[model samples]
Structure formats: C-alpha cells, structure tokens
Target: MYRWLLLSYPRDYRRKRGAEILETVRDTAVTHRGTRVAANLVRHGLRARLGRPASRTVVLWATVFTLACGLFTASFGTWLTWLGSRPLDHDELAVAVNQLYPDKPVSHIDRDDPPSVFIIYGSPLSWSSASDLLLGDGGEYSLAGLGASFEQLPADSRPRVLAELLQRLRASGWDDTEAVYSNAYDCVPDDPRCDPATIPSNITVYAQRGDDILEVSINDDSTTPKMSLALTRSTPWSAYPVGVVAFVLGALSGWCLFGWASRRLEVRGPLAQGSAKFLFGFAMVMWWAPILLSTSLMLSHHLSEPHPRWHPLWEWLGQPAMSLAFLCGCLALGVAALSHRLPADQTLAHP
Candidate 1:
C-alpha cells in the first residue's frame, strides 16, 4: 500500500527519494492510526504534485490550484488539436513530396547543388538512427577517427571501417559523382568544395525510399528536422488510458472532499463544518494548480514558438496562487474551529 502511494511521485523522483519517503511514512504509521497515516499519505502526495512545500497556508494553495486548472484546460485542449493535425507517419510526407515533384523521374534523381543540399526522409525512429550515424561519437561528420562505433560497420568487406565511413558521407550529403567517381578520399588542402574544412559542420540528406520521400535537414546548430518512416499510422491509444486514469482520480478526489464537507457541517456543528469546507476547498486547489501550470508550460514549450519571456511569468504565477489559495482555506478552517468552540446559539448567529 505504501509502495502504491509512492507511485504518485515522478519516476526519477521516486527512484531517488522513494526509500526515504517510505521510511518516513512507515515511522509515521507506527505512531498514528491507519486513517491518519492514509491522510498524511494523501496530503504528501498532493504536495508532491503541486511541487511546493506541504506546510504552505490553505488560501494560497487554493488560489494556485484554481489557476492551474485554468492553465491545464487551455493547454490540453491546444495539444490535442495540434497532435491531431500533425502527420502520423512517413506516408504523409511521401504524398506531400509526390505532389511537389510530379514531373521528376522517381529513379536516378541527381542534383549539382553543394553536398549541403541532400534531404533526409525517414520515420522518427529511423531518423533517430540516422542521427546516431551522423552525430554519434565517430559519426561520419565527427572529426576523423573520433567517436567511432566499429559495431556499426557491416560484415564481409576489407576496408570495412572506411567503407562504412564513406557510406555515411554519401548518405549525409556527398553527391554520387563525388562519392563514387571522384577521389573523395584524396586529401585536398585548397580544393574549394573537396577541402575537408570547407564542408559545412552539418549536412542534409534527402530520402525517397519506401512510402515517404521527405527531407531530413540538419544544420550546424545541431537541430534536425522531423524525419518520417513510411509506416502504418497508429492511434495514440496509450495516452487514452492515462487520460482516463486522471479523470477518474480527479473525480474521486472531488467526491471525497464533498462527502467530508457534508459530514462536518451536519455532525460537527457550524464551526467544524465551515473549517472542513475551507480545508477541503483549499486542498482541492493545491492538488490541481501545479498540475495545470506544469501542463501549460510543457505545452507552450513544445508546440508553440512563443516568446521565451512569457514562459517564466506563467511558471511564476503558480507559486503565489498556490500560497493564496492555501491561506484562504486555512482562514476558513480557523473560522470553523472558533465556531465549534462557541455556544450553539452564537454559532448560528454568526453563520
């Protein structure tokens, strides 16, 4: 059960701190009732989600939670729409390319432009492999003999390492004439195009294989364009399971808080009821605010080419909002506690 509770933490965080947190929980459980232990577990779970100190006042926490909800709703809706519109696989790229180059023969394509002009076309997975070929230690583009992975070389060939190296250069951007016909291996100190130093730090590769015929362009800045592999597109069903779980957990939390509030008011009198209501409200806010803010930040960072300055403000607002929400909640709880201490008639009059 305790291990299950720890699952609420991020994976990296759990790996680093799970043992210590579990130990603390166990000690707390030994000193308190199981119900209290559960409550603490939940409280800590929420604090972790909020990315804030658990000791924060209630009003601040509530405000943060509300803001977070707003951010999350906006961001998630935007992401779902964007993802829906994006190409799912390489087939989409092939279709787009065919439409662009209708007159060109599909085979024996050639271009005289600099080696920097080749386009790379592949799936995301293949693109990752291609990147390793180009940028990994001893990659074709790397300084000679450095960062080499000899395992990448194919079997049954003399000068196998050299052949593998030349193949990468050809795939990267070297023209067929330059790669196969010319003495590409010959070191030329001053030849304008052939000079090793003249070669751009990055190269582009255009692929027209399988279903996709798109270009994977690389730049000196180390950013590579998205690559596509021609494969059947599959729906993102995995995300659906996660979304369902989140919806269920959110619903359960809301329900539990509502029930707790109802009991406090009916059985514990006005003060206790009010306090419980406030605390519950505050807890709800704290629980959701960080989640919403983080979602918004992540979406904005990944999907939109928005200005950098805007991101910090979004992240910054989260902290104060959480603090204010928690503070308000604590005030309400205090008011409820005071009401419980007073006479029933006084409680009724104040309420």
Candidate 2:
C-alpha cells in the first residue's frame, strides 16, 4: 500500500527517495500512523509534481489551471455518458403527448432531433460553423428533447388538467414532485406596488421514470405559450462517477503540464518566455470566458423554471457551441510549446 502511494510522486523524485520514504512510513506504521503518512505522501507528492516549492504564485496559477481543466474534462465525461442513453423517438413523443391530452391533440410542436446529441446550430460541430458558434447562433446549442406548446389552453381548466395528469402519472408508475408556482412575469415579491393577487403565477410539474424525464409547464404570459411539455433524458448514473474521476485526472495533468512549462521557461531568454506568457494569456481567455458567460446564463434559465434535471455540464460550460473557442485556446498552447524551442542557444541547463 505504501509503495503504491509513492507512485503519485514524479518519476525522478520517486527514484531518488522512494526507499527513504517507504522506510519512514514503515517505521511509523502504528495503528493510525500509516493512514496519516499515506495522506501526507499523496499531498506532498502532488506538491512535488509542481516544481517551484518556494513560489506561492506557481501554486496559485497551477490550481486555477487545474480547476479549469477539471471542469472541461467533467463536462466531456458527462457528454459521453449522455450519448449512451436513449433519445426520445418520434413515436415515443407522440404517445406521451397523446397520453397527457387525449381529447386535444397538440397543435404546435417542437422536437429536439439534432444531427448530434450535443449540437451547434442544429448540426454537428465543425469549423465551417465558427461564425454561428461565436457570433450567429451559439445560444441554440442544447441537448436533444421533445417539446410541445398549447397556445389556447383555457386558464380555468388548467387546475383540473394538472391535478388529473399528476394522479394519472403517479398511477402509471411515474415518480413526481409537487407543482411549483411562481409569477409568469418579472414581479418583485417584496414590492408593495406589485400586488401578488394581480400577477398570474405559472404552474410547473416534473415527473420521472427510469432515465426519462417529463416537465409540464402552464404559463399565463401573453407572449409565451399557454401550456408546454418537455420530455428529455436524465444524466445516466455512471456519468457522476465518470465525471468525478475525469476531473481528478484532468486536474493532475493540467498541474503537471503547467509546472513543466513554468520550469522550462524560467531558464530561457526574454523573447521565448514573453511569447509563452502572451500565448497562455490568450488561451486562458478563450477557454474560460465562454464557460463563465454560459454558466451564468444557464443558471438564470434554470432558476426561472422548474428544472428537475439540470442540463448537462457541457451545456453549462458552452461546449461544442464554444468548441471553436476551445480550439483556439489549444492552438495557442501549441504555439507556446513551439516558442519554447525558438531560442535553443539561450536555453541553460537547470534541475
């Protein structure tokens, strides 16, 4: 067990001090000493992986880069897991709609049948659509789902319909949550001028069975649909663990790579080092800015509605949609790597 834990350290560090570390661990192998030593080994091993032990700035930047890598990795893992789950087919969606409202066939319908499970501009990710992803229709990227709208649903009958639907879904082996009621418009809850009784509240219910989710929304907003239904697949159970493991691995990789670049550049001349810094800055801005923007927007959207199952992590990070930005960041990193070799004569040997 102690030997296995030592693998966390860098290859050179392990070769030099592996025996000494194992000897110390065995010497302190009392009831709880082994556990404590194991934890310390992992912590320090990770710290050793990032070379500048004396510089606090290195640790801080390493942490930031690691976290960014982890987020993107987790999103990618979640997206892969999503691909394994089944999408709602046309027949399945039709049946669900019919079951919900047998008397009234849904008049207006919108289905999510994108070329790819994760889509940008109704198509698979490609460089040709860079314009759409960045400036045209990036916001359109979303997971596949089925949606229907009822523009003429009577307000008086909404309560009865919702009640019956809930009872029916429950009887049919579907698990459900209590309906959430909130104002359809932007009304300040604490404002005396905004009368609660005067404002119409929307009704929303969420139900689940297996990996599938159903959302029923009844709204009173004049511009919005009167009633809407959305059917989508929930994130698979395996995705959680996969995402977590991917995040940890990605963080380690990011830290190690950053440390290598930092240490290598320290011995180089001004031009190479300066180029690396500028390229890294541009890459970070490209990669991280879209994540921040998309995360905020997705959070607000979820808060505005009753989202039983949140959208995939990639969507929140502005994935395939902002894949162009991610690609640009990668190119910058590649250029930075090239810059390291430009001034071979100025490079000095360093430990």
User: What TM-score fits each model?
Assistant: 0.25, 0.78
Q: State the lDDT of candidate 1 residue by residue for 1-351, as single tens digits.
A: 888877555455679988998898888888789788877776665445434243345435444444444443333433343244324333343444344334433332222221221112321223454444334221122100001011211222324433443465356443322111112135557666676643433222333333222232222322221211121222233435444454455444533333333333555656554556567566555545544675576577645432211222222334322444434554654554343443456444554
Q: Report the lDDT of model 2 for residue 19.
A: 99
Among all windows of 10 consecutive residues in model 1, the one with the lowest summed lDDT is 142-151
Error of 2 at 292 (Å): 4.3
Give lDDT per model, in order.
Answer: 0.41, 0.79
**On residues 58-147, what C-alpha lDDT tens digit does candidate 2 reach at each position?**
777678778889998888888788888776675666767777677875766765454556555556767786777766476676776678
**Relative to the unseen true structure, what is the C-alpha lDDT of residue 296 in candidate 2, on a scale of 0 to 100?**
97
Per-candidate clashes, comma-separated: 41, 0
lDDT of 1 at 290: 49
